[model samples]
Target: MVRFSYEGSSERNLKMIITFDLVNTSNSDGRTSLQDESRSGRPNTANNDWNTARVDELIKVDRRVKRKEISLKLDILKTNIYESVYDKLGYRKVSARWVPKMSDEHKRQRVEISQILLHRCQQEGDETVE
Candidate 1:
């Protein structure tokens, strides 16, 4: 049909045909509908606000806490712990150290410090002074 004319690979077209056939058969048999049915399984509860807050607090207390340690302490999977720390809390690791993503204030401070050091070096007129 014109609706199926959208460019797609043969594999995709085959899958669409199979899905259509399955849906048609199910409808004819009155077994199911096209709508998604509720799945049964343990829902993802590790990356919630409570866990995020807990993880943030732990990070604040010790920025170098490992993901494995957090997973053990919080009873969450390592992947979930990583997601909470990085994606949700906006943290990244540097030099084997966990730190929050730098904001504008941090950038400004870094630039200010470097400029001050550079000016001091220029005034000293000695490049190799320790």
Candidate 2:
């Protein structure tokens, strides 16, 4: 079927490419798309999966590891490491330590604690609670 599909040195190469493209295409049952595939602009070099994994490991090893420390250890830019830690790892700085962003449970606990503080302030007076 790929014999005359495209001008290729071998039909095998064209068949493989066509099959790959078909697999990538969504909802295209039997139609061959001539349009060029959309590209995901300039690739991220440092902020890729491999670096993100390394960044995660470093954070796990030391909760208080600074961005500069990671940058030096991984030999990557601090800015790129910052993106991996914050964006990919879902972590944030708290009291000079890197901590994972609060989960739903933590958020619920915070609400309960706030309610308790508010109740104490109302019953025992704000000055006493403070």
TM-score of each: 0.56, 0.52
How many times do residue backbones clash in model 2?
A: 0
Considering only N, C-alpha and C atoms within 3 Å, which residue pairs clash in candidate 1?
none
Candidate 1 — which residues are off by over 4 angstroms? 1-43, 127-130
Off by over 4 Å in 2: 1-42, 113-130
- Cα displacement (angstroms), candidate 2, residue 98, comes to 0.8
**Tens-digit lDDT string for candidate 2 (39-83):** 888866998899899999998999999999999999999889878
Clash pairs, candidate 2, are none
Q: Cα lDDT for residue 5, model 1?
A: 30
Model 1 TM-score, 2 decimals: 0.56
